[model samples]
Target: MDSHRIIREAEGEVWVSCKIPGKPTIRGSLTSKGISSDEVPEVTASEEFVVQEVTKNRITVSCPEENISCTFLSPYASFSHIHEKNVSYLDISSGGDLGVSSSTDQTFKVWETHNTEVKSVLEGHTRDVFSCKFFPSGQEVLSGGLDSLVKVWSVNDGSCLATMKGHRGSILDIAVVADGQNVISSGQDGTARLWDSAQGACIAVVDDSYSPINAIAVAEVGNAVNLGSPKETPSNREVGTEGKLVVLAREDKSLEGVSLHSRQSVFDFDGSDAFNCCTFISSVGVLAGGLDGNIIHVDIRNPKSAVETVSWSETPVLSLVPFRDTYVASYGNGTCYIPLKGSEQVLQLTGPNRQPVFQVAAWKKLVYTCCRDGFIRKYEIPDLG
Candidate 1:
C-alpha cells in the first residue's frame, strides 16, 4: 500500500487524490477505517494502493502492496496576514485585488489582497479611524474618523485629496453614491449627510433621525416604490438619487429608512435592542442586527413587523456580509453565522480566538474578516458542484 495525504476533510469524512505513475490521478473519499480497491477510481496501475492515515502534511498509505507516503499542500497558505493594531474596519476593492483596512492605531493602510503586501499607509487622520471604504471605481478611499472629518485619499500615491468637515461628532459609517460622484456618511451626531466628492462640499443632510446612526446601507429602489420628489431641490442631480433608499441602523434600537433624494422617512421599525449593523440582502429585503442577540429581516414596504428573526447566540451581532443566497454575520463572542433565507441549518465560521470579529468583506470566492485579535483571516468557499 502507498501513502496518500489528506487533501480536504469535512464532517467525519476525508478525501485524498492520488497521482500514480503512467496513469491519471485518482480522487476518492476514505470510508470506514481504510481504503478498498474499489474506492480508487480511474487508477489502472498494477500497484495496490491503500490509505493508512492522513496527517497534516503526509499521508501513510499502501501503494502496490507496500506502504508509501504522499505530500499535500494547501493552495491558500499565502493568504493570511496580521495587522500591527486591532483592525476596526475593512473593505475590499470591487476588482477583488486591493484590500483596505483601518485600525485603532489611528492609521489606514492599503495592501494587496492576494499576497498581503503593504501598498501604502494613508496618514492624516488625527484620531482613530472608524470607517473606511473604496469608491466604486476603486481608485480612491474615503475614511471618516474621531476627528469629526471625512477625508478622501488617492489610492495611487497615498495623498490626501480632500477633507470634508462638518460633523460635530465622530463619523461612524460611510456609503458611496453611484459613480463616485457623491458620498454619504452617518455620524454620532445623529445625522447622515451627503457630499459632493468632486467639489468636497455638503450637498444635503438626511437628518430625519435624532438617534446616532451606527450603520448605513444604500440600495436601489424600483419604480414601484413611492419615493416622492424633493420638495426643495438642492441640485439637478436629485433625479439620480430618487430611486434609492438609505437604511440606517440607529443606536436607539430602531431601524430607519430614508429616501436618498427627498430626505423623507420611508419606514422605521423598533428592534430587540440597539442596532449595531445593517445590510441589504435584496432591493426590498433588509437585515439588521442588535445587542439583544436578534437578527431581524424585514421588507421596507412592510416593515411594521420583521419578516423573520434569527437568534442563534446570546452575543450581540457586530458585522454582516451578503453571500450567495444568504448572509453571514459576526457576533461579539467571536462567532460567525451564515443563515440562508429558507433553510433551518446555519453555517458557523469559527477561528477568531473568542475575540470579536469587527468587520467582514467578501469578494469573488474569498471571504475576509478582521477580528479584535488583530489578524485578518481569509476563508475560501468550497465549490458546491
Candidate 2:
C-alpha cells in the first residue's frame, strides 16, 4: 500500500487538497457555518503539481506547465484496515484502541483497531446479533440481537456478565451512558428501553411507538435542557444524567427524542420517510436520516421545522456520525457523504462494494464503517498542514 496523507489547516475556514496514488486529485473545503462559496477551489490532478500559495484560510497547488490549478480542501479520510465479515453493527471504544463488531454470522467479536487483531469472540445469542457497542469504560461491551436480549460482556475475558430480556422483537440499537452504568436500546417491537448494565435490569420503557424503532442514539444535551417526567425516576444514575436523551429513528417516518433519565418524550418530528438512523451533532442540534435518502437537521428546542435538509443520494441513510466540524452519513448504496460547512460539494467515502453500510463509528480522527459486504472499512483523517 502506498502511504500518503492530505493535510488541512483552518482559519475562518479550512482548505485541503492533495493527490493519492490510485485515486484522482482530491479537493474540497470545510466550514463551520454550513456556508458554500463559489470561490472554493476546483478538483484537479496532474503528473506533477507544485505548492503555489498558502494562506490562513486557503492553500493552492498547481501544475503550471499542465495548466491544472486546484484549490480547496482535499479529502480528509483515507482507507486504513478492513475487517472481513458481513458486519451488521460496530462501535469504536472511547479510548480508540478497540472495536466491537457484530456480523451476519451471528457472532460478536472484539478486535484491536490499530493492527486488526481479533481479541475476543462473544457468544450467547441464539440468533443474529444486530448491534454491539463499547461501553464508555471500554472494558465492557453491550449488545442486542434478534434473540430479544441485551447482553453485557467483559472485553478482557469475553465472559457474558449479564443478559437482560423483555423486548418482543429484535433489538435494533444500543447506547451507553458516559459512566457505563446505564444502557439504552431500541427495537423492532416499537419500544425503546433503558437498562442498568451492572445489574442487568430493565430500568424503564422509554417509549412504545407501535412502529418499529429502527435505530437509536444517546446524546448528552445541554446542562439546562429539561425533560418532563416519568412514572419513576431512573435508578443508580450518575451525575449529569439529566442531560441525556435517547434519539430514535422509527418505522413511522418520525424522528423522536426521549429523556434517558425521565423516560419522557422530548420531541417527535415527522420525517419525509421512515427514519433509519439518528445522531447528535451537538447538544442542541440533532440529525436524522431516512429511507428517502434525506438527512434532516433540527434544533431540539424548536423542532417544528428542520433547520436544514440534505439530499445526497436515493439510498436509505443507514448511519450518521459527527466528524470534525461536519457530519458523515452512510447510505444503503454504500455511499457515504461527509459534508463540509462552506463547501457545496461533499466528500465521498470510497472503497465500498455498493453494499449497505449498516453503521458508522468514529474515534479521534479515525472513522469506521460496517458494511453488508462483510467488511469493516477503516479511514483516517490527516493532520493539518
lDDT (10s digit) by residue, model 1, range 1-385: 1112233333234443444344555554544343335442122222344554443332334443222333222223323343677888999999999999988766689998878888989999999999899998899999998998998999988999888888989999998888777888999999998988767788888874678999999989776467777788568543357688999999999998888988888898998799999999999999998988789999988989999887656679899789887887888877676653553333445456568888988887777888777778776654321
- The 0-to-1 C-alpha lDDT of every candidate, in the order given, reads 0.74, 0.73
**Model 1: how far residue 232 lies from native, Å:** 1.1
Runs in model 2 deviating more than 4 A are: 1-84, 223-225, 230-240, 383-385
- Per-candidate Cα RMSD to the true structure, in Å, reads 10.9, 9.4
Give the alpha carbon lDDT tens digit for every residue of 1-385 in model 2. 0011123312243333444334465454433332236433322323344555443333445544434443333333322233345788889998999988888777788988767688998989999898888877899999999999999999999999999988998998888777778788889999988777778888778798799999887777855367766566446543345778878889899888888767778888999899988888988898999899889998998889999987766678998999887887888877676765764334556556467888888887777888887777776644422
TM-score of each: 0.79, 0.78
Give candidate 1's total backbone clashes: 10
Clashes of 2: 7
